[model samples]
Target: MRKNLAGVRNRLLQVVALYAPGGDSTRVRLHRLRGVEIGEDTWIGFDTLIEPSYPHRVVIGRRVAVGMRVLILAHFAHHGRNRESSEGTMDDRVSVRIEDDAFIGPGVMIMPNVTIGAGAVVAAGSVVTRSVAPLTMVQGNPAKPIARCGIPLGLDTPIKEFYRRLTPIEPPAE
Candidate 1:
Protein backbone atom coordinates (compact mmCIF):
# COMPACT_ATOMS: atom_id res chain seq x y z
CA MET A 1 0.00 0.00 0.00
CA ARG A 2 2.19 2.81 1.23
CA LYS A 3 5.31 1.20 -0.20
CA ASN A 4 3.64 0.66 -3.55
CA LEU A 5 2.54 4.27 -3.68
CA ALA A 6 6.04 5.41 -2.86
CA GLY A 7 7.49 3.24 -5.58
CA VAL A 8 5.10 4.65 -8.14
CA ARG A 9 5.85 8.19 -7.03
CA ASN A 10 9.55 7.61 -7.26
CA ARG A 11 9.27 6.25 -10.78
CA LEU A 12 7.16 9.22 -11.84
CA LEU A 13 9.69 11.58 -10.38
CA GLN A 14 12.48 9.83 -12.24
CA VAL A 15 10.62 10.16 -15.53
CA VAL A 16 9.90 13.84 -14.96
CA ALA A 17 13.44 14.52 -13.91
CA LEU A 18 14.80 12.89 -17.04
CA TYR A 19 12.55 14.79 -19.47
CA ALA A 20 12.22 18.16 -17.81
CA PRO A 21 14.35 20.90 -19.31
CA GLY A 22 17.35 22.00 -17.25
CA GLY A 23 16.86 19.09 -14.89
CA ASP A 24 20.32 17.61 -14.86
CA SER A 25 20.31 15.42 -11.78
CA THR A 26 18.51 12.49 -13.34
CA ARG A 27 20.69 9.75 -14.84
CA VAL A 28 18.55 7.71 -17.22
CA ARG A 29 16.08 8.07 -20.09
CA LEU A 30 13.95 4.99 -20.77
CA HIS A 31 11.48 4.49 -23.57
CA ARG A 32 9.26 1.43 -23.78
CA LEU A 33 11.43 -0.29 -21.24
CA ARG A 34 10.36 -3.85 -20.45
CA GLY A 35 11.84 -6.74 -18.47
CA VAL A 36 15.14 -4.86 -18.05
CA GLU A 37 16.43 -4.40 -14.56
CA ILE A 38 18.70 -1.45 -13.73
CA GLY A 39 20.94 -1.77 -10.72
CA GLU A 40 21.15 0.59 -7.78
CA ASP A 41 23.14 3.86 -7.70
CA THR A 42 23.70 3.92 -11.44
CA TRP A 43 24.19 7.30 -13.04
CA ILE A 44 22.77 7.71 -16.50
CA GLY A 45 23.79 11.02 -18.05
CA PHE A 46 21.57 13.50 -19.80
CA ASP A 47 20.63 12.74 -23.43
CA THR A 48 21.30 9.05 -22.92
CA LEU A 49 18.69 6.86 -24.60
CA ILE A 50 17.68 3.26 -23.83
CA GLU A 51 15.04 1.10 -25.40
CA PRO A 52 14.13 -2.53 -24.92
CA SER A 53 12.59 -4.01 -28.04
CA TYR A 54 12.82 -7.77 -27.64
CA PRO A 55 11.37 -10.60 -25.59
CA HIS A 56 14.76 -11.75 -24.31
CA ARG A 57 15.00 -8.55 -22.20
CA VAL A 58 17.63 -5.88 -21.55
CA VAL A 59 19.38 -5.82 -18.21
CA ILE A 60 21.53 -3.12 -16.60
CA GLY A 61 23.66 -3.88 -13.58
CA ARG A 62 24.52 -1.74 -10.56
CA ARG A 63 26.82 1.26 -10.19
CA VAL A 64 27.06 1.83 -13.92
CA ALA A 65 27.76 5.25 -15.46
CA VAL A 66 26.45 6.07 -18.90
CA GLY A 67 27.68 9.33 -20.37
CA MET A 68 25.68 11.97 -22.19
CA ARG A 69 24.50 11.39 -25.75
CA VAL A 70 25.11 7.68 -25.45
CA LEU A 71 22.69 5.47 -27.33
CA ILE A 72 21.87 1.98 -26.05
CA LEU A 73 19.45 0.23 -28.33
CA ALA A 74 18.21 -3.26 -27.57
CA HIS A 75 16.37 -3.96 -30.77
CA PHE A 76 15.41 -2.72 -34.21
CA ALA A 77 11.75 -2.99 -35.11
CA HIS A 78 11.74 -3.84 -38.76
CA HIS A 79 8.04 -3.23 -39.25
CA GLY A 80 8.51 -1.32 -42.46
CA ARG A 81 10.68 -3.98 -44.01
CA ASN A 82 8.47 -6.74 -42.73
CA ARG A 83 5.39 -5.26 -44.33
CA GLU A 84 7.10 -5.20 -47.71
CA SER A 85 8.58 -8.68 -47.44
CA SER A 86 6.82 -11.70 -48.91
CA GLU A 87 8.04 -13.92 -46.07
CA GLY A 88 5.69 -14.65 -43.20
CA THR A 89 8.27 -14.12 -40.52
CA MET A 90 10.72 -11.28 -40.07
CA ASP A 91 14.07 -11.09 -38.31
CA ASP A 92 13.75 -7.98 -36.25
CA ARG A 93 14.73 -7.18 -32.61
CA VAL A 94 17.34 -8.37 -30.11
CA SER A 95 18.28 -7.87 -26.46
CA VAL A 96 21.19 -5.99 -24.83
CA ARG A 97 22.71 -5.99 -21.37
CA ILE A 98 25.25 -3.93 -19.42
CA GLU A 99 26.88 -5.46 -16.38
CA ASP A 100 27.88 -3.82 -13.09
CA ASP A 101 30.37 -0.96 -12.79
CA ALA A 102 30.58 -0.46 -16.54
CA PHE A 103 31.39 3.04 -17.80
CA ILE A 104 30.15 4.10 -21.20
CA GLY A 105 31.49 7.40 -22.50
CA PRO A 106 29.66 10.12 -24.35
CA GLY A 107 28.55 9.56 -27.94
CA VAL A 108 29.01 5.83 -27.56
CA MET A 109 26.59 3.55 -29.39
CA ILE A 110 25.73 0.03 -28.26
CA MET A 111 23.82 -2.27 -30.55
CA PRO A 112 21.47 -5.17 -29.81
CA ASN A 113 22.30 -8.70 -28.59
CA VAL A 114 25.51 -7.55 -26.91
CA THR A 115 26.51 -7.74 -23.28
CA ILE A 116 29.03 -5.35 -21.75
CA GLY A 117 30.93 -7.10 -19.00
CA ALA A 118 31.48 -5.70 -15.53
CA GLY A 119 34.15 -3.06 -14.93
CA ALA A 120 34.47 -2.40 -18.64
CA VAL A 121 35.05 1.05 -20.12
CA VAL A 122 33.79 2.05 -23.53
CA ALA A 123 35.55 5.11 -24.92
CA ALA A 124 33.88 8.26 -26.13
CA GLY A 125 32.39 8.15 -29.63
CA SER A 126 33.06 4.43 -29.85
CA VAL A 127 30.60 2.18 -31.60
CA VAL A 128 30.31 -1.10 -29.72
CA THR A 129 29.54 -3.71 -32.32
CA ARG A 130 30.48 -6.63 -30.11
CA SER A 131 30.55 -7.71 -26.50
CA VAL A 132 33.22 -6.11 -24.31
CA ALA A 133 35.15 -8.23 -21.85
CA PRO A 134 35.37 -7.47 -18.15
CA LEU A 135 37.87 -4.91 -16.83
CA THR A 136 38.86 -3.98 -20.36
CA MET A 137 39.16 -0.52 -21.89
CA VAL A 138 38.05 -0.23 -25.49
CA GLN A 139 38.29 2.71 -27.92
CA GLY A 140 38.05 3.77 -31.58
CA ASN A 141 35.22 3.76 -34.13
CA PRO A 142 34.69 0.01 -34.02
CA ALA A 143 35.57 -0.13 -30.31
CA LYS A 144 38.64 -2.33 -30.09
CA PRO A 145 40.41 -2.97 -26.81
CA ILE A 146 43.28 -0.55 -26.50
CA ALA A 147 44.27 -1.72 -23.02
CA ARG A 148 43.07 -3.36 -19.87
CA CYS A 149 41.62 -0.99 -17.30
CA GLY A 150 43.56 -2.02 -14.19
CA ILE A 151 46.73 -3.06 -16.06
CA PRO A 152 49.79 -0.81 -16.15
CA LEU A 153 50.30 0.96 -19.48
CA GLY A 154 54.04 1.56 -18.74
CA LEU A 155 54.09 4.32 -16.07
CA ASP A 156 53.51 1.81 -13.25
CA THR A 157 49.91 3.11 -12.98
CA PRO A 158 46.81 1.57 -14.45
CA ILE A 159 44.82 3.20 -17.27
CA LYS A 160 41.72 2.98 -15.13
CA GLU A 161 43.34 5.24 -12.54
CA PHE A 162 44.16 7.79 -15.18
CA TYR A 163 40.58 7.83 -16.40
CA ARG A 164 39.30 8.20 -12.87
CA ARG A 165 41.31 11.39 -12.46
CA LEU A 166 40.03 12.86 -15.72
CA THR A 167 37.45 15.62 -15.51
CA PRO A 168 35.32 16.29 -18.52
CA ILE A 169 35.25 19.94 -19.53
CA GLU A 170 31.90 21.38 -20.50
CA PRO A 171 31.69 23.95 -23.26
CA PRO A 172 30.35 27.43 -22.65
CA ALA A 173 26.65 27.81 -23.26
CA GLU A 174 25.59 29.97 -26.20
Candidate 2:
Protein backbone atom coordinates (compact mmCIF):
# COMPACT_ATOMS: atom_id res chain seq x y z
CA MET A 1 0.00 0.00 0.00
CA ARG A 2 2.76 2.35 0.87
CA LYS A 3 4.53 1.65 -2.42
CA ASN A 4 1.39 2.38 -4.39
CA LEU A 5 0.89 5.62 -2.48
CA ALA A 6 4.42 6.72 -3.20
CA GLY A 7 3.99 6.02 -6.91
CA VAL A 8 0.79 8.02 -6.93
CA ARG A 9 2.47 10.87 -5.15
CA ASN A 10 5.29 10.98 -7.64
CA ARG A 11 2.93 10.89 -10.59
CA LEU A 12 0.90 13.68 -9.10
CA LEU A 13 3.96 15.78 -8.61
CA GLN A 14 5.00 15.32 -12.23
CA VAL A 15 1.62 16.43 -13.49
CA VAL A 16 1.55 19.45 -11.27
CA ALA A 17 5.05 20.45 -12.19
CA LEU A 18 4.37 20.36 -15.91
CA TYR A 19 1.36 22.63 -15.61
CA ALA A 20 2.83 25.06 -13.12
CA PRO A 21 3.66 28.65 -14.10
CA GLY A 22 7.39 28.24 -13.59
CA GLY A 23 9.53 28.10 -16.71
CA ASP A 24 12.12 25.69 -18.05
CA SER A 25 14.02 25.28 -14.80
CA THR A 26 10.87 24.13 -13.06
CA ARG A 27 10.09 21.68 -15.81
CA VAL A 28 13.64 20.36 -15.68
CA ARG A 29 13.42 19.86 -11.97
CA LEU A 30 10.19 17.88 -12.20
CA HIS A 31 11.37 15.88 -15.19
CA ARG A 32 14.59 14.96 -13.45
CA LEU A 33 12.58 13.77 -10.51
CA ARG A 34 10.84 11.47 -12.97
CA GLY A 35 14.27 10.39 -14.33
CA VAL A 36 14.29 12.23 -17.64
CA GLU A 37 17.66 13.77 -18.55
CA ILE A 38 17.21 17.37 -19.68
CA GLY A 39 20.46 19.26 -20.18
CA GLU A 40 21.40 22.83 -19.32
CA ASP A 41 19.32 25.83 -20.50
CA THR A 42 16.78 23.67 -22.30
CA TRP A 43 13.20 24.86 -22.24
CA ILE A 44 10.39 22.40 -22.78
CA GLY A 45 7.30 24.43 -23.61
CA PHE A 46 3.81 24.06 -22.21
CA ASP A 47 1.64 21.11 -23.30
CA THR A 48 4.64 19.11 -24.47
CA LEU A 49 4.38 15.40 -23.66
CA ILE A 50 7.56 13.53 -22.91
CA GLU A 51 7.44 9.76 -23.18
CA PRO A 52 5.52 8.47 -20.22
CA SER A 53 6.32 4.81 -20.79
CA TYR A 54 10.06 5.36 -20.59
CA PRO A 55 10.75 8.88 -19.44
CA HIS A 56 14.31 7.98 -18.54
CA ARG A 57 14.95 6.92 -22.14
CA VAL A 58 14.66 10.50 -23.38
CA VAL A 59 17.73 12.73 -23.33
CA ILE A 60 17.37 16.41 -24.24
CA GLY A 61 20.57 18.34 -24.76
CA ARG A 62 21.62 21.85 -23.78
CA ARG A 63 20.00 24.98 -25.27
CA VAL A 64 17.27 22.96 -26.95
CA ALA A 65 13.79 24.39 -27.37
CA VAL A 66 10.91 21.96 -27.45
CA GLY A 67 7.84 23.86 -28.55
CA MET A 68 4.32 23.62 -27.22
CA ARG A 69 2.31 20.48 -27.97
CA VAL A 70 5.40 18.57 -29.07
CA LEU A 71 5.20 14.84 -28.51
CA ILE A 72 8.37 12.90 -27.78
CA LEU A 73 7.65 9.20 -27.60
CA ALA A 74 10.06 6.49 -26.51
CA HIS A 75 7.84 3.41 -26.69
CA PHE A 76 5.83 1.74 -29.45
CA ALA A 77 3.36 -1.14 -29.40
CA HIS A 78 1.15 -2.81 -31.98
CA HIS A 79 -1.02 -5.86 -31.53
CA GLY A 80 -1.23 -8.54 -34.20
CA ARG A 81 -4.15 -10.77 -35.18
CA ASN A 82 -3.80 -12.85 -32.05
CA ARG A 83 -4.50 -9.98 -29.69
CA GLU A 84 -4.82 -11.91 -26.44
CA SER A 85 -1.42 -13.54 -26.57
CA SER A 86 1.69 -11.64 -25.57
CA GLU A 87 3.47 -12.74 -28.76
CA GLY A 88 0.85 -11.00 -30.84
CA THR A 89 2.03 -7.59 -29.83
CA MET A 90 5.47 -6.19 -30.35
CA ASP A 91 6.29 -3.81 -27.54
CA ASP A 92 9.56 -1.98 -27.30
CA ARG A 93 11.06 0.98 -25.54
CA VAL A 94 13.69 2.96 -27.43
CA SER A 95 15.87 5.89 -26.44
CA VAL A 96 15.44 9.36 -27.91
CA ARG A 97 18.15 11.98 -27.94
CA ILE A 98 17.94 15.60 -29.03
CA GLU A 99 21.37 17.14 -29.42
CA ASP A 100 22.32 20.64 -28.36
CA ASP A 101 20.67 23.75 -29.89
CA ALA A 102 17.96 21.83 -31.74
CA PHE A 103 14.54 23.41 -32.18
CA ILE A 104 11.47 21.20 -32.18
CA GLY A 105 8.49 23.18 -33.37
CA PRO A 106 4.95 23.01 -32.06
CA GLY A 107 2.91 19.84 -32.66
CA VAL A 108 5.91 17.83 -33.83
CA MET A 109 5.74 14.11 -33.19
CA ILE A 110 9.09 12.46 -32.67
CA MET A 111 8.96 8.69 -32.63
CA PRO A 112 10.96 6.20 -30.61
CA ASN A 113 14.68 5.62 -31.16
CA VAL A 114 15.12 8.98 -32.90
CA THR A 115 18.08 11.29 -32.50
CA ILE A 116 17.75 14.93 -33.56
CA GLY A 117 21.23 16.13 -34.43
CA ALA A 118 22.76 19.34 -33.14
CA GLY A 119 21.31 22.62 -34.50
CA ALA A 120 18.58 20.79 -36.41
CA VAL A 121 15.23 22.48 -36.87
CA VAL A 122 11.98 20.53 -37.05
CA ALA A 123 9.16 22.51 -38.61
CA ALA A 124 5.76 22.73 -37.03
CA GLY A 125 3.52 19.64 -37.27
CA SER A 126 6.31 17.45 -38.63
CA VAL A 127 6.14 13.72 -38.09
CA VAL A 128 9.70 12.50 -37.75
CA THR A 129 10.20 8.89 -38.76
CA ARG A 130 13.98 8.96 -39.13
CA SER A 131 16.90 10.68 -37.48
CA VAL A 132 17.80 14.17 -38.65
CA ALA A 133 21.28 15.30 -39.64
CA PRO A 134 23.10 18.09 -37.89
CA LEU A 135 22.14 21.67 -38.90
CA THR A 136 19.31 20.52 -41.18
CA MET A 137 15.72 21.69 -41.37
CA VAL A 138 13.01 19.07 -41.81
CA GLN A 139 9.31 19.31 -42.41
CA GLY A 140 6.08 17.48 -43.43
CA ASN A 141 4.80 14.00 -42.79
CA PRO A 142 7.56 11.45 -42.24
CA ALA A 143 9.75 14.53 -42.32
CA LYS A 144 12.25 15.02 -45.12
CA PRO A 145 14.92 17.65 -45.19
CA ILE A 146 13.75 20.74 -47.00
CA ALA A 147 16.83 22.75 -46.19
CA ARG A 148 20.36 22.07 -45.01
CA CYS A 149 22.07 24.69 -42.92
CA GLY A 150 25.52 26.03 -43.64
CA ILE A 151 28.46 25.27 -41.40
CA PRO A 152 27.92 26.79 -37.97
CA LEU A 153 30.04 29.77 -36.85
CA GLY A 154 32.71 27.32 -35.60
CA LEU A 155 31.06 27.75 -32.24
CA ASP A 156 27.74 28.07 -30.51
CA THR A 157 25.51 30.95 -31.64
CA PRO A 158 23.20 32.13 -28.96
CA ILE A 159 19.49 32.77 -29.64
CA LYS A 160 20.11 36.51 -29.51
CA GLU A 161 22.39 36.17 -32.53
CA PHE A 162 19.43 35.20 -34.68
CA TYR A 163 17.55 38.38 -33.73
CA ARG A 164 20.66 40.47 -34.15
CA ARG A 165 21.04 39.22 -37.69
CA LEU A 166 17.41 40.01 -38.43
CA THR A 167 17.20 43.58 -37.17
CA PRO A 168 19.64 46.11 -38.59
CA ILE A 169 22.18 47.59 -36.17
CA GLU A 170 22.29 51.39 -36.04
CA PRO A 171 25.56 52.87 -37.23
CA PRO A 172 27.37 55.09 -34.69
CA ALA A 173 27.14 58.86 -35.28
CA GLU A 174 29.94 60.16 -37.48
Candidate 3:
Protein backbone atom coordinates (compact mmCIF):
# COMPACT_ATOMS: atom_id res chain seq x y z
CA MET A 1 0.00 0.00 0.00
CA ARG A 2 2.83 2.40 0.90
CA LYS A 3 4.66 1.61 -2.33
CA ASN A 4 1.54 2.25 -4.39
CA LEU A 5 0.96 5.56 -2.65
CA ALA A 6 4.52 6.66 -3.31
CA GLY A 7 4.16 5.77 -6.98
CA VAL A 8 0.97 7.78 -7.27
CA ARG A 9 2.52 10.76 -5.54
CA ASN A 10 5.53 10.62 -7.83
CA ARG A 11 3.28 10.62 -10.90
CA LEU A 12 1.36 13.64 -9.64
CA LEU A 13 4.56 15.55 -8.95
CA GLN A 14 5.95 14.62 -12.39
CA VAL A 15 2.93 16.10 -14.11
CA VAL A 16 3.11 19.24 -11.98
CA ALA A 17 6.81 19.67 -12.58
CA LEU A 18 6.41 19.48 -16.34
CA TYR A 19 4.00 22.41 -16.42
CA ALA A 20 4.78 24.19 -13.17
CA PRO A 21 4.00 27.92 -12.93
CA GLY A 22 7.45 29.09 -11.87
CA GLY A 23 10.74 28.60 -13.64
CA ASP A 24 13.78 26.48 -12.75
CA SER A 25 13.35 26.80 -9.00
CA THR A 26 9.83 25.42 -9.05
CA ARG A 27 10.72 22.57 -11.38
CA VAL A 28 13.87 21.70 -9.47
CA ARG A 29 12.04 21.76 -6.16
CA LEU A 30 9.34 19.41 -7.43
CA HIS A 31 11.81 17.01 -9.05
CA ARG A 32 13.96 16.94 -5.92
CA LEU A 33 10.90 16.24 -3.82
CA ARG A 34 10.09 13.39 -6.22
CA GLY A 35 13.58 11.88 -5.62
CA VAL A 36 15.82 13.30 -8.37
CA GLU A 37 19.18 14.43 -6.94
CA ILE A 38 19.31 17.90 -8.45
CA GLY A 39 22.15 20.15 -7.34
CA GLU A 40 22.46 23.90 -6.83
CA ASP A 41 21.19 26.35 -9.49
CA THR A 42 20.35 23.73 -12.11
CA TRP A 43 17.75 24.63 -14.70
CA ILE A 44 15.09 22.21 -15.91
CA GLY A 45 13.21 23.67 -18.84
CA PHE A 46 9.55 23.23 -19.79
CA ASP A 47 8.16 19.80 -20.64
CA THR A 48 11.27 17.86 -19.64
CA LEU A 49 10.49 14.26 -18.66
CA ILE A 50 12.89 12.82 -16.16
CA GLU A 51 12.90 9.20 -14.96
CA PRO A 52 9.42 8.07 -13.95
CA SER A 53 10.31 4.57 -12.85
CA TYR A 54 13.27 5.44 -10.64
CA PRO A 55 13.62 9.17 -10.20
CA HIS A 56 16.23 8.53 -7.51
CA ARG A 57 18.58 7.20 -10.16
CA VAL A 58 18.75 10.42 -12.13
CA VAL A 59 21.35 12.78 -10.66
CA ILE A 60 21.81 16.30 -11.99
CA GLY A 61 24.84 18.26 -10.85
CA ARG A 62 25.42 21.96 -10.19
CA ARG A 63 24.62 24.58 -12.86
CA VAL A 64 23.36 22.01 -15.34
CA ALA A 65 20.78 23.10 -17.90
CA VAL A 66 18.29 20.58 -19.22
CA GLY A 67 16.48 22.03 -22.21
CA MET A 68 12.82 21.82 -23.14
CA ARG A 69 11.43 18.48 -24.39
CA VAL A 70 14.47 16.61 -23.07
CA LEU A 71 14.06 13.08 -21.74
CA ILE A 72 16.43 11.65 -19.15
CA LEU A 73 15.66 8.03 -18.40
CA ALA A 74 17.29 5.92 -15.72
CA HIS A 75 15.71 2.47 -16.06
CA PHE A 76 14.19 0.32 -18.77
CA ALA A 77 10.89 0.01 -16.77
CA HIS A 78 10.22 -3.24 -18.64
CA HIS A 79 12.93 -5.84 -18.37
CA GLY A 80 10.74 -8.53 -19.89
CA ARG A 81 7.13 -9.76 -19.99
CA ASN A 82 7.44 -11.40 -16.58
CA ARG A 83 4.99 -10.14 -13.97
CA GLU A 84 7.52 -10.39 -11.10
CA SER A 85 10.06 -8.29 -12.98
CA SER A 86 7.53 -5.60 -13.77
CA GLU A 87 6.33 -5.32 -10.14
CA GLY A 88 9.75 -4.81 -8.59
CA THR A 89 12.69 -2.54 -9.31
CA MET A 90 15.58 -3.91 -11.33
CA ASP A 91 18.54 -4.56 -9.03
CA ASP A 92 21.11 -4.14 -11.75
CA ARG A 93 19.83 -0.78 -12.98
CA VAL A 94 22.46 1.93 -13.12
CA SER A 95 22.10 5.65 -12.42
CA VAL A 96 22.23 8.31 -15.13
CA ARG A 97 24.65 10.95 -13.85
CA ILE A 98 24.96 14.42 -15.35
CA GLU A 99 27.96 16.15 -13.85
CA ASP A 100 28.37 19.89 -13.09
CA ASP A 101 28.14 22.61 -15.76
CA ALA A 102 26.74 20.41 -18.52
CA PHE A 103 24.30 21.72 -21.12
CA ILE A 104 21.73 19.36 -22.56
CA GLY A 105 20.05 20.96 -25.57
CA PRO A 106 16.38 20.71 -26.48
CA GLY A 107 14.93 17.39 -27.64
CA VAL A 108 17.92 15.41 -26.40
CA MET A 109 17.27 11.90 -25.07
CA ILE A 110 19.74 10.49 -22.58
CA MET A 111 19.63 6.79 -21.81
CA PRO A 112 20.39 4.94 -18.57
CA ASN A 113 23.88 4.11 -17.25
CA VAL A 114 25.47 6.98 -19.14
CA THR A 115 27.50 9.69 -17.38
CA ILE A 116 27.40 13.06 -19.08
CA GLY A 117 30.72 14.50 -18.00
CA ALA A 118 31.22 17.94 -16.45
CA GLY A 119 31.16 20.93 -18.86
CA ALA A 120 29.96 18.78 -21.76
CA VAL A 121 27.57 20.20 -24.37
CA VAL A 122 24.93 18.06 -26.04
CA ALA A 123 23.61 19.89 -29.08
CA ALA A 124 19.93 20.19 -29.91
CA GLY A 125 17.99 17.13 -31.12
CA SER A 126 20.79 14.71 -30.29
CA VAL A 127 20.25 11.22 -28.89
CA VAL A 128 22.97 10.39 -26.40
CA THR A 129 23.85 6.70 -26.61
CA ARG A 130 27.09 6.64 -24.62
CA SER A 131 29.00 8.63 -22.00
CA VAL A 132 30.23 12.04 -23.10
CA ALA A 133 33.67 13.26 -22.04
CA PRO A 134 34.25 16.38 -19.95
CA LEU A 135 34.26 19.72 -21.85
CA THR A 136 33.23 17.95 -25.05
CA MET A 137 30.52 19.06 -27.42
CA VAL A 138 28.45 16.35 -29.09
CA GLN A 139 25.70 16.24 -31.72
CA GLY A 140 23.64 13.80 -33.84
CA ASN A 141 21.53 10.67 -33.39
CA PRO A 142 24.28 8.72 -31.67
CA ALA A 143 25.90 11.91 -30.26
CA LYS A 144 29.48 11.99 -31.45
CA PRO A 145 32.06 14.49 -30.22
CA ILE A 146 32.18 17.67 -32.31
CA ALA A 147 34.66 19.82 -30.41
CA ARG A 148 36.69 20.24 -27.23
CA CYS A 149 35.57 23.18 -25.16
CA GLY A 150 38.24 25.19 -23.36
CA ILE A 151 35.84 26.62 -20.82
CA PRO A 152 32.43 25.59 -19.58
CA LEU A 153 29.64 27.71 -21.02
CA GLY A 154 28.57 29.43 -17.84
CA LEU A 155 27.65 33.01 -16.88
CA ASP A 156 31.22 33.60 -15.78
CA THR A 157 32.71 32.41 -19.09
CA PRO A 158 33.01 35.02 -21.82
CA ILE A 159 31.02 34.17 -24.96
CA LYS A 160 33.71 35.25 -27.42
CA GLU A 161 36.46 33.46 -25.50
CA PHE A 162 34.41 30.27 -25.31
CA TYR A 163 33.87 30.24 -29.08
CA ARG A 164 37.45 31.19 -29.80
CA ARG A 165 38.82 28.36 -27.65
CA LEU A 166 36.77 25.58 -29.26
CA THR A 167 38.82 22.96 -31.11
CA PRO A 168 36.78 21.03 -33.65
CA ILE A 169 37.46 17.34 -34.00
CA GLU A 170 38.39 16.14 -37.48
CA PRO A 171 35.91 13.67 -38.94
CA PRO A 172 37.05 10.07 -39.17
CA ALA A 173 38.51 8.93 -42.49
CA GLU A 174 35.76 7.56 -44.68
Clash totals in order: 1, 0, 0
Candidate 2: global Cα-lDDT?
A: 0.74
Write the candidate numbers in order of decreasing lDDT: 3, 2, 1
lDDT of 2 by residue, 1-174 (tens): 995875676677667655766557777788777767888888787877787645777899888888887888886753342245443322322369999888898899999889999978888999998999888778899988876655321125654654343322243569
- Residue by residue across 40-135, what tens digits does model 1's lDDT show? 666677766565233225677777777877787766665663453454333343367888888888899998778888878888999998999877
lDDT string, candidate 3, 1-174, tens digits = 998999999999999999996546999999999999999988898999999868887889999988998999887666552434443545334479999999899999998889999999999999998999999999999999999999888646788998999999998999
TM-score of each: 0.62, 0.73, 0.90
Instruction: Mark the regions of model 2 whose C-alpha exceeds 4 Å error after superposition.
Output: 1-10, 78-94, 151-174
Give the Å shift of residue 13 in candidate 2: 3.6
Candidate 1 lDDT (Cα, whole model)?
Answer: 0.64
Better-scoring candidate (lDDT), 2 or 3: 3
What is candidate 3's local distance difference test score? 0.89
